[model samples]
Every structure is written in structure tokens, then in C-alpha cells.
Target: MASNIIHFEKDIEFSKKVVLNTSKKFPDPKFIFSETSWKLDQFQNLKTKLNFVKHKLNDFILEEWHEHTSKMNPSGLVVNHVRKHIHPDFLTQAWCKFYEIMCNSSLVSQKSLLTGNMCSVHLCEAPGAFISALNHFMALNHQSIKFDWLAMTLNPYHESNGHPDTVSDDRLIFSTIDKWEFGPDYTGDIFQPRYHEHLYETISKKFDNGASLVTADGSIDCSDDPGEQENIVMSLHNYEMMVALNIIQNGGSFVLKMFTIFECNTICRIYLLCCLFQSVEIQKPATSKSGNSEVYVVCKGYMGRSLATPYIQMFFKSKNHDNALLPLSQIPNNFIDELYNCSSYFCDLQIKTIEKNIITWNNKNESYKEINEIQRIICQEYVNRYKLKPIRWDQDVISSSNWSRARNNKRKINISYSEKLRRRDLCLQEEAVLLYQEIVNFSNSKTNECHEILWGRCDQVSLNISNVKYCLGKPVIQVRSSKFCNDSLLQYRIKIINKFPCIDSLSNSESRILYFKTKLNYSKNGINICDLTDTYAKNRNNNVILQYSCLFNILETLQQKSEDFLLIGYPLYTQIAVACFFVIASMFDTFAIIKPDRNFGHAFAFFGFKNLENWLNILSEVLKYILPRNDSYTRSKLALVSWLPIQQLVKQRSHLDIVLLNNLCIAYEVEPILLSFIQS
Candidate 1:
């Protein structure tokens, strides 16, 4: 390619001017890059070091430059003038002031540290605030402590000079965190970012004196003694260059400012610190809104490993540190689906409760089968609440250079309704049959016929004998009531905390079910001298003679993690029919939503769990209820099968049964799904 020459002349003048200005401001606030000093253990001393008026003028100049560069950006998103008032000089002054703040004050506290002071590193998704806060603190007065901030000052003077339009718009201004070279450009801008030179020097001094921020790497693991560290604060959200978790210590308290990470992601993080910290407390800051970037803190873990090691390292394959330097690559091809299909992305997680809060079931239905169904319903409700639009599958979220050109010439896909209905009807058939088989299996086991009969099910599945479209109507479902009934301990309690039948509940049903027993004395006559079994008789509510074989807690898990109503893509009629038989093996229900999240989890964990006996049974019941599956109860085991990945729904359309269940709920006072189910 031939090169153009008009760019050189313009750039030369700007570069020269920037150098001249840098030299003039260089002496305004004399900076110390030495190893030893008095009243110098913190950045606060650096603030008092600068000349006020001279430093102010220099700060003003930098802001002016930043404002000019923003206007020159390719994507025309500039700060709103009405509220932000971001001018070039204003931005520069902001950066300098931020640096002065970083220099003079401590964003971290001694209470936040132990024998070693820990400096937690955070990235700001909105970089401006990061710098602004630093400036406000630094340009003003000293706090009790000062932190080393690596805030950036964009090189605005380079604007209009006609440089190559490569990525590198963001530049690091002042901070002692790192060298501040260009890493991945997360969102806003990640072009040619320049960093400060004296950071390494300042930080090294902190280390030699053993007063550095936190412990450095594995050799200094202290997750067990968090009360030792100072007050912890997490304010940044953009830079992924450093291991944010490593910046703090074990048992250290925290003020985390989280925005988009999912509840699961948070759980995973805490799980990693399980060993290092005795207890972990996670909370959202009051200053945050449900719609804003969310925040939460991981009470510091002090040992070699925390309680959640497995969960923390559960995700993400190793990405090389060297490769981390590339400017955020087109948001990558894989991130879009994860935003909603699996976990939270950068978007604010808005937890929506109905205008009228969700109802709490009053009736107590403690039957074994019904309680399991309630858990299924809760999970479904969550999915519906957070689910996003379907996305197309691709290696890269952004169209490749070649893909961009080809996409414009590509064709669209289409399908029909009659075909969709036929498919769903077949699914309903399979659902019915699977339910009957489980009843037969439990009856045939000879494990106390009363046990089989006492565990009542199908107590109330509202039928729609009318001209309705889908659903068995609303089943006043035993699952909804079983979880809260008084017989919970006798029925499902396992551990002290698991008594509520929830993995995280206060007490488990399994652990409490076997508390009562009658001691027997052996006579010389042996069996001939045995006494009558009347002593074993008691209130069913007072004693639960649980048959462990009959209850593997599988049903309980399904109640928690499964979805009774599955949504699928249109044209997936074949998949729907197969879903009927899968009921027994899947222990999952089928509702017909056809979306990405359902499809992927279904495809991935289809048979991945250690115990599917209960899942298979519940799934069999769901298929029997939803499909005409009851007729073929003795047939093959793949009744609930669906080769179609739920991920495919990211491309297709459908609905989940829980959402339908919710619709049935809102209409419970009016039309009741149970009325429709039984009547039909």
C-alpha cells in the first residue's frame, strides 16, 4: 500500500508542543521516585508536595486535551454536556488532580491490612469516575491514608494530527499499580494507552520496607486472618489486567462495588475462599441502584486456599498474561451467549419482582412428589425473570472482516405453526406415559405399599377441557406446598441446614427423619418371644419412617434446579416428541419455551449428574402430564429426549412452562390452570 505524506507535518507540531508543556509542568510539583523518605509511607505526602496554583494550571491543560480527543473519536459518543460538562482542559485537570489525590491520600486503610498492608486493585468500567474520585481526594485534603492510583490521562494533544486509526485511545496517567501498558480494551476505549514511569519505583519502596499493599502472590497467602487487614474497598470495574482477588488478604473485610456479576458468579467466588476465611459475608452497597453497576465484597480469605477454591477456579481456561495485552478484541466471539445463557455479563442485573409481590402458598401439601415440583417452578421463574433475547451462534460476536461482507449477502430462515403444534402435541403424549411408570415402579418395589400410596401425587393438575392452546392447566402442584409443610422434617430433611429441603436451607429433612426409634430386647426364645409391633405406631407427622431407597433427594434437587415447563424453538417438533420419553432419565420437565439458556444446560448436563433416578422419574411425570406419554409407559427410556440444543433457541423461538405457570398464577383467581387440566 502506498503511504500518504500530509500526516507528518501536522503531527510534528503537536508532539513538540506536548513536550514543551510537559517540561513546564514537570517542575510545578516535584515528584520523588526514591527509596527512603520521612512521612512518605503513603501517597498523602505526595499531595502536599505539589505547588497548588502551578499544579492546578497543569491539571487544567490536561483536561482540555482529553475533551478534544473524545470529540475526534470514531464512534461519536461524547460525554453529555448538560450534566457532565467534560471539556478537554477539565478532563486533564481531573486526571492530574486524581494523580495528586493518589499521591497524597490513601484509598485503602491500615485496618484493611494485617502484618502486611494490602492494596486491593480494581478497574473502573467507567474510567472517568475513577480519575475524578482520585482528583477530588488528591487535589483537596489528606484522608487518614493514601493509596497509589494508576489513573490515566488521555493524550489529547495527539488529536487532529492524522495518526493511524488503530486501537489505543485510552492512556494510563498516574498510579503505582503496574507499568500501565495497553492491555485488553474492555469496553469504552482501549487504544494506545500510555502509563507512568515512576510507579515501579514507588511500589518497590513499599515492598522493601515490608509496608507494601497486601501480600504478593502465593508465597504470602493469608486468607485465614482477614481481621488483620485494613478496611477493604472495591470501586473499579474495567481493567482485567491484575488478579483483583489477589489484591486483598484473608479474613479482610470489604466494601465491594459490583454491578453485573450473577448470583452464581458471586457464589463461585466465595467458594474459592472457603478454606482461607472462616466466614464470608457478601452485601450490596446502599449507594447502588438495582439498575446500576452492582457491587459486593468477598470477606478476605487468609489461608493457602479459601472455602471456595473449586468454585472460583471453576470457570475460565487459562488466558496468557502476554495475550492479555491485546486491546479488547471485538468483545470476543463467545461472550454474547454467556451474558444471559449462563451467567451475568457487564449489564446491570435488574431483579424484577411483580408489582404485586409473588404469592406465598398457604396450603401444606407434604406429599413426596409435589414438593419436588415446587423447586422446579422456582428455578423456572428465575430463568424467565432474567432471560434475554435469543442470539445467533458464532465463533465471534463481532462479524469478522470477511463475515461482515458475507452477512449482507446471506439468506434468512423460516418455519410454520401447524408443524409446531403437531410437534408439541407429540411431546405431551410422551409426558403422560412416563408419569405412570414411576408409580408402577414404586408400587412393584414392595417397599411398604403404604409408602407408595402415602406419597400422594397428581393431587391437583388443573385441566383445560375447553378450547385452550397449551398446558395441562395449573396443577395446584404438591411441590408448591410440600416445601413449607410441618411434616418437612419427616419427609425431606437431610442435614441440620438442609431441613428446609434446600441445599442452603437452615435444616435438612434427611437428617431429621430418623430421630425416633424403639429399642428391642432379645429373649432366649429368639423370634418366638418377639413382642407385637404396636410400639412403632405413632402420628405420621410426629415420625417419618423414611425408606432411604425410595428417596434419593433427586426429586428435591429437581424441585430446586429443574424447570417444569420447557420452551423450545419452532420446527423442533421432533425434539418435542423425543422430550416425552426423556422425562424418566432427565428428572426435568418440559414446557415448550425454545430459548438459549434452557437448550444449553439441557444439552450439557443431560446425563452429567451422578443421580438421575429421581430426575428421570420427575421428568417422566412431566412428560406424562404434558405429552400423551402415559400410553407408552412400558416403552423406551429416551422419552424426554431432545437432540436439539437449547442453545439453538438463541436462534429460534418458544416459551417455558414456569412462565406459563406464572401466567396461570396471575389468572389463578380467574381461570385456574388446574381446572383446565383435570377437566380436559
Candidate 2:
């Protein structure tokens, strides 16, 4: 046994030295000017090295090399052979290896034998190649086991600087030609513990006895330096194992893709997985290339959650620690540690030998240089075939030979400039003659109507109030009677007494009680008086009405008495109400106040005046105060009290119907009526 161990040690040392020597002859360039050139040079050197190793190896090993190289490109083989079944990519090979391990281990057969449905979870599954492979395998073999799948991957919606951080390839999903059979909501970075915690909670609720299978193909971006790249790859592998151990049920299986175990960190992770699993196997499937360092670690039959949870917790706690190895106490058994070390050592030796042999074979065969050149040429041809045409900025116009030929074939026709202008002038002359004839015909038809207006009954001196009332809707109530009806002051008054009674109507307690029944009836149909007044005031267009009113003079006088009255003394609503009153008063020939009982009164009484006599006293006082009240202004102002009030009073005594008022509020420029009511 001792001699056998020594022989194994010697073999490992020899393989390592061979690998080093093969790589050293073709040292990677410090700076590669073009990726194509670098790849071509590397390919030539690798082919030469591979050929050399073939001559040195035994017949069995050389046969395996021949089988692998005969395919030349496995991706091309996959595309051609199973082009309809699977996507031709590295992911397809990884998934094929995983499926073979599961099948060969009887995991799929056992699950099919069981009564319950099998649940599987896939981590970092974007482009969904593993899912397609699993679906294909299950469809072909284990039709008895109903499978439920959930997958987690980077969120395509996650943004960095307003652009998608990861964009999924839709072709991968569509290439399967089947509707997705898994839960699609599982998304986000798996490195985050919260994502794991969420999955744990979901599994606890939905899944019976946890998931039956967990597969992780997680990896991080690797650096060129082998040591740093190994560290990154191991860290990612450990994190994936940590999650798989936490979620996978007892008797469940886990398939992990990991690099060759060259570093202590990778070996340590494998040791931990071995401790928690009933069986562990490292496999490199035929689908995988002979030269690459990737291998799959298949762990089957988990040793129950009780045995794994504590180690899982410890892993999370010590994850931040710089040391890659777990504490001695964390190891479940001493035998696991020894077994893991032995297996890892063997794996490292095997990987080095394979890499060395590939390099030796490639270096020995000079024919590989021709193959490399051919590959570069084919690659360049493919690139050129698919490359997008660059934009051409030099050409201002697109030249079309077909269009030029068509234009050249057409017959030419031209006209003189003088002839074109003469034809246009002839058309204009014909239009002018037609227009003159139309005007003459229209004048002949309208002659009678024009004459009646020029010397009509409107010029007659016998036109009376009855004739004026017949012509206009309302009886003429002149400020000072003039010959023409148009000259008379027009007024409009909205009878809102029933709809909105004056505030002064509610002042006397006895009157309020007496009119309570009538007031209640009015309140039901009554619009808000303040809102109506405010709207009218806000929308008033004729500023001339306020400029000519006695109310403006009253406000100006009041403003002189107290400087801050506009700010503090007067409320805005009250000002709006007062402005509404003045705007209504100014537009009328005689401002009439129709009391609730159909009694005639002066308009001022509606503004809280005790009687007509009191209102007249205030009006006389206001007139005395306003200076330079000329004939026109004085007449216009007095017109507010002249005809309408007298007519109302006469109508009350005579028992006549009150005539409807005409258009009083003319649509013209007016100040905000509230501004007219702002007092001191």
C-alpha cells in the first residue's frame, strides 16, 4: 500500500511538470493587439502540444483523445445532431452532463417510483438551457413523476444608470418550443440572503418535504491570473452550496458546476458538501471539451435537514471570514475530510494530465497550424457575413439605376413662360367680370330694404312709449328721453329675490320668525347667494360700469378714512356682494327692488336701507360728495333711480305686470367687481 501511494504521488508530480512545460513554451502575450491573432497563435501552439502528448500516452488514452478531437467542435456536433432538440451552447453541454449523472445515479428512477410529485429548483437559470434539458429528459424517460420547477436568476428589470443590467436572450426560451412549465416569479440576485430566506419561506409553505432536486450553475467573472480566478470561482461555488444545502430535502440531489479543484478553498467546499451528502461524485461528461478545466460535482441523498442546518448556519456566519477552511468542529466526520482531500488530489492530477496532453498533441502536429489558419479564415467569413453595413455619410442622394432608366425613357414636354402668364391673366379677368355681375344683381334685390331704413318710421316724431314697447321687448325707460330708441339706457336685472334673499332680510328677529316658513321653502331651491355674487363679481367684464358708479366714489371716500380698511376692516365676501349690487344697479335705467310680497321699493332698501326716504337721503349725500358731476355723468347716475322704480311703484298701484328687462350686462371689458367694492 505504501508503495502504491508513492507511485500515485510520483504520477501526480510528473503530470504537473508536464502541464507546466507545455504551457511555458507558448507563453501568453503581455498585450494582444487583436483578439483574432492571439486566438490563432494560441490554437496553433495547443494543437502542436496535443499531438506530442498523443505519441507519449498509452493506446487507451490516445483513443479517448482521438474520439474527442474527431468531433473537432462539439458545439457544431450538437447543432447538427440534436439541432431540433437543444440549443447548441456551453449551457446545453453542462445540462446534458447533469441529466446523465442524475439518471445514472437512479435519482430520477427513485423519484418516479415514489407516490408524490417531484419538485426541483434551479439557481442562476437565465437563458433556461438546464430547464429545457430537464424537460427533455423527463419527457423521454420519467413520465410517471409529475415535476414542478422553480427558477431564480438575475432580474432583467434591475437597472444600472437607467439601462438594464442583465438582458435575457429570448432565443434560448423560444428555441425549446415549449411553454415554460416552472414558476417565473423567482428572480433576483442569489448572493443576497434575503432571496434565500424568501425561497425558504416559500418552500416551507408550498413544497411538501422541501424540494427533491436543486441545481446551481452559478459562476463569477474570472480574472486572467489563475490564483485570483480560482478564488473567485471557489467563493461563488461555496455560496451556491450554502443555498443548496439549506433548501434541498433529505434524499434530494444537488448538481453543481465547479472548476477543477486546484485551490484549498475549492477542496474545503467539496469537503463540506461530502459531509452533508450520503454520496458525492465528480464527473466530466463526454459533452464537455477535453481541454477545459470544468467538472460537475454530483451530491445525492442529502443526510436530512437536522444534520445539515447547523453546518449551513455556521457557513453563513463564517462566510465573511478570510479563511477558506471550515472550523474542525464543523466537520461531521474525520473520514469525510480524508476522502475529500484524496478525491480532490486525484481530480487535480487528472485535470493537469488532460490539459498537458491537449497542449502536447497540439504542439507536436504541424498540421494543426493549417487547421488553425483555416478556423481563423472561417471565423472571419462568418463575421463578415453577419456584420451590419456601416452608415455612408458621403452620399447626399440615393442613386437608383432603375429610376434613371425610367426617366430617360419618358418623353419630354415644355411650355413657354410668356404663354403660361398670359393664360393665368385671362382666367383672372374672367373671374373679375363674374364677380361684378353678382354684385349688380345683389344691389338690385336689396334696394327697397335700404331705402326703407334710410327714410323709415324711425325718423317719425310720433313714436311714443307704446310704439317703443312694441318694437323692443321692454318699455322704454329713458335716463333722459332721446329721439332714437337705441340711445335709451338698457338695463338687465336678475330677479334672485326668491332664490337668494338679501342678508338684511334675516336681520330683524320678528321678521325672521314671521318669514321662517317662506324662508325654509326658499332655502330648498335657493342657490348660495354668496357664491353667485362672487362668481358674478369675478367674471364681470365691464370696468366702465364701476368707473361710472356712485359705489366707486363711496369706496374711494371710505378708503380715505382708514388706510388699513382694505386689509382688515372689510371681508372679501362682503366686498364681492357689494360689487355685485353696484354692477346690477349701473346696468339698469331705473334700479327697482321687488320685495318678497310683490311690494315696490327702492333698490337701496335691498342693501339694508330702512325706507325709500332713507335711501334717497343717502343718494343725495353721495351725489353731493362726488365732484364735477357733469350733465352726462349726473344723468347717467340719476338714471339708476329714474324710470324703473317709478314704473314699479306705478305698476304696484295700477296693478300692471312688470315688463321683462332687456340685455343689461353687455359683454365688454370690466374690472373684477370685488376690486370696485374694496373699502377703507
Candidate 3:
């Protein structure tokens, strides 16, 4: 293949000189750059030189790659131009990298690696781009091979995974959630040792031996400490390697993303990789920006696991110890020289390109004819070399039978509200089971009075009413009812919240209740509820818009008060109702859902307003449909609830898993009562 690739092989004589024997003490890394070693000094000096230009030229250099160089690479531009659906840029980068590696190396063509049935595992693979890329490759080349794959990453939706730490994009995972293994804790954090064990066991069960291929594109944000990028990501690099070594099949191929090879930890890891695989090749794909230090290590033809067991033990055991793997003095002198040369080569290339980009940025009016010519040649070469064809795997991926199953599981697992009543045969969760027992006990009582149960729990502390500075004077809780709900039941629930006519009995409630009615027009057929089975319901969309407008208006008046909120009864059987519920729930720090009646869907109580401004953009999209339009172009804004993708809906939904579960528990309990009432 016509690509920039550097290959390394195991030197038998050099390997004999080093200690390959087993030892109880793990091979740890501890090395400092010394003046005596010119190779180390040279590598460090080049890095220092690169850092000098980085501050001012970083953005210019990146723009140069994105706007010019990467587009010149044929494979990089192919996917974007030919694929029907849009995807993350990393998807195309992964495809280009893998395509070059597969073509240049003996990964795909080798019979030993391309078995009839193959399995692969991707670590730190959120929003799964590499998996999709591989799927496309297999469909094009190895169509007869049965490919089964698994992936894991920091769970984006898990509350424990905070911002800047997890991949918040769920565009791909929303459809392929089942293929991911998020460990026993469901955090998908590979840094945790337990996750490694769980992933190993899972791979073992499916492949028996292990996965035929393992890929890890894990990295940490080192922008804060750019000089120590290698050091900052050293521990993660080790963990990824250990997991891959443990889960990969004998004669399998392993691909890992890494940075510069200057640090002792990095050099040691690369040397260890060279010893385990028949060949280790480092390549910075044409798609990757020249301004960055990112590169992929493609290791192929793994020696059997038994042979690597001792090294694996050392790798894991080194975690707690401060010992050195083969100290700086023990690694082969020839290998050290090769490492220094490789580091300097890439560093020099980066520095030169950065300088050129700096000039280009200053010259703002630079001609693009050269770039266009380069792009034409590369595009032609790529099409001819790979037999390129239009690829559209985004729809093909989500349209599988598993999509429906994953959607169903998402609802049942307390991720969202269920449009339909809970089925008796449906498996009940631990929380649901306990709530069911509570409901049965309540049903056996003789009292017929209306009641409100606090089934949902939110740990968020209520705002201190005295310290508040919002426009609203006191804490106010407004109760609202939709046309679909029973007005008598709604009034009774409001009375319960207000503790009406019992104020002299020494209660401590200070909040005042206000009642509002939704202006929904009821028809003979009632509200047309649409479930996930139906993508769109055209009849009752206007009612949905009216409800959205009412809620949006209510939200517009909200302030950051401690106890100012609305207790609303709305049916969640329609997509718009569910979307609007999420919008309201997300704006409050503390929220709960009440099942005021057995036949009702859900009644929500949101408290302590927060993040209201952030959601107003989406809510405002509904108003374009409600307002009068003057031009044809202005009517393009349809109801976001009906037009938005399921993934977008999932991403916008609040972290109200408990609230969903609480409502579902009531759904399960009320099923029998509603059934008996109907029979009578």
C-alpha cells in the first residue's frame, strides 16, 4: 500500500541478550533522560523545538490538515462523499487507517487470521466508529466470514460519567447498545481492573479461545499538560495493552492508538509489543492531521497466549510496584537507537509542516490548485486500488432486528416512560417488585380517599426558600390537568397536595397550590396516542403542539426558586408528551412522577428549577409550527418531537431513571385492577 508505515521485527540475537525469563517482580518503567545518551537527548531536544512553534501555529496547522491535506487523501474523502448518512469524522479516519493497515500488512489476506467465523472486541469504543468501519470492510471483502463483535466504553448516560470524561454522543450507541459490554458496574471504564476481567470472560464465552481481532482507540485530554502527554496517558496505554493481550486470540491482530515514543514507559510498551507479535508496524495514516502526534500501532501474528502469559502477569503485577521493567540499561541498544530515530523522524516532519502552515495562514490568499490536483490523483488511486463503492451502513446497522429489542429494553430498564400499560408477563425489576408489594398492601385497606405516594427519589437538596432571589415571592406548586385525565381525580390530588381544610391541625407545609387547565380539544376518539411501533401520528399533532405551547409558556415564567414548580397530569402514550416531559423534568434538580389514578399514564412533580434556559431552544422549535408563517421557507420547522431521531430524544431526556421506574411500578400494580374493572 502507498502509505507512511514503519515496521519492526523481533531480533532473535538481541532478544537472546535481554532477559526473557519469568520473574515474580513485574517489569515496571522508571527512566530519566540523561546527558550521556545522545539519542535520548536528541529526541527530547526535538520535542522541545516542536513545543516552541505549537502555541501560535496549532489552530492554523489543524485547519491546514482539515481543509487541505486530509481531503487530498483519497480514502479519507471517499466515505464523506459516498456515504448517505453523516457520521463523526473519526469514523472516516478509522476506515482510512484500517484500510491502509489491512492492505499493507498481511492482516486480511492471511488465511490464519481470516477464519470462517471471526470475533473482535473494541475497548474504549463509545459511539462505535471503528466497529462500523470494520463492518463495512467485511461486507466488501470478507463477505463469507461470520463476524461477531463486542465493544465497551465509559457509559455516557451513567450519571457517574461526568462531562469531558465520557463520549456524550449516543448517535451510534442508541441503536447498538446491546453489542456493548459495560462491565458488571456498567461504567465501561477500562482503567478499573474488574472491567478487564469481565470483558475477558465475555470474550472467552463467545470465541472460546479469544477474539480474532482487538482494537483500542483510547486517549486522554492532554491539552492542559501538553509537554507530558505521553506521561499523562501512560497508565491508560498500559491498561489497554493488558486488556488486549488478555482477550486477543492466538495469531490474532491487535491495533492500539498511541502518541510519541519518547517516554521510557512508551518505549518499553512498544518493545514488549515487538516481542509478542510477529510484526509491529507504526503508521500515521494520511487521514490523520500532520500537526498532531497521533499514530496507530498495528500488531499482527500474535504468538499463542500461553507464551505471553508470563509477560501478561508482569504487566498486571507492575501496577502497584515501583520496579523497572528492563531498566533503561537493559533494553537492546539497537532497539533504543531505532526508537530515537522514529521519534525524531515524526517530530521533524511535524515541525516542518507546522512552519509551512504558519506561512499559509499568513498568506490568506494562497492558491488551492495544488491541493485540488493532489486530491484528484489520490482519489483516483484510492478508487482503483480498493475498488471503491458507495457505502451506507448507518441505516443498515440500526435497521436490524436487534434495534427493536434494544428499544424495548431501554424502556423496561427505567430509561424512559412506557407508552403502553405494563404487561404481567414482563419481567419485574427489584424496585418494581417492592413497589408492587406496597401497592397490593394499599389495595387491601378499606379507605377510598385519594392519595399521593412518593415513589420516586431524588437526592438533590431543596433550595433554601429564605435565601432565594428570584422574581417569585414565595414557594408555589401549581397543579395542572390535561383533557385526557379525570378533572375530579385532578382536583382530589390538588387537595391532597394542599392538605385542604386541615391547616389548623399543625402541618408544616408552606407552599401554595395553583390549578391550571390545558386547553386541549377532546374528540370522540379521545387523544390519539402513538407508540414506538408507529413513527408518526398525523391526526393529533395539533393537540401535541398546543400542549407544548402551554408548557413552554409555563417554563418561560420559571425562575431559580427553591420550591416553585408544577405538578402535572399528562398521558405519556405519545412521543410529544414524552419529549415535553423530559424537557420539564430536566429543568428541575428534583423531580418525581405520581400515578394519581390507576388508568392514568403519569403525573409529574418537578422542583427547584435549573437548566431551563438550555432547553428553551428545543422547546421554541415547537412554536414555529404554532405561529403564523409569512413565507414558504418559514414553514420548514416541523414539530421537533415528531421529526427528531430517537437518538436525539434519548440524549435530551433527563437522568430520571428512578422516576420512570416509579411510574412503571404503578403501571405493573394497576394492571390487574383495570383488567377486573373492565371485565365487570
TM-score of each: 0.23, 0.40, 0.56
Clashes of 2: 26
Name the candidate that leads on TM-score. Answer: 3
- Largest lDDT belongs to which candidate? 3
Model 1 bad stretches (over 4 Å): 1-107, 111-120, 124-128, 131-146, 151-242, 247-265, 274-281, 298-680
lDDT of candidate 1 over 150-249, digit per residue (tens): 3222221111111122112222221111322222111112221211112223333433331122211111111222111111111112122123333333
C-alpha lDDT (0 to 100) for residue 262 of candidate 3? 75
lDDT, model 1: 0.24
The number of clashing residue pairs in model 3 is 2
lDDT of 2: 0.39
For model 2, give the 10-residue run with minimal summed lDDT.
661-670
RMSD of candidates 1 onward, in order:
28.3, 35.0, 21.4
- Quote the positional error of residue 372 for candidate 1 in Å: 46
- Candidate 2 residues lying further than 4 Å off, grouped into runs, are 1-76, 84-91, 109-112, 161-167, 170-187, 328-680
Worst 10 residues of 3 by lDDT: 5-14
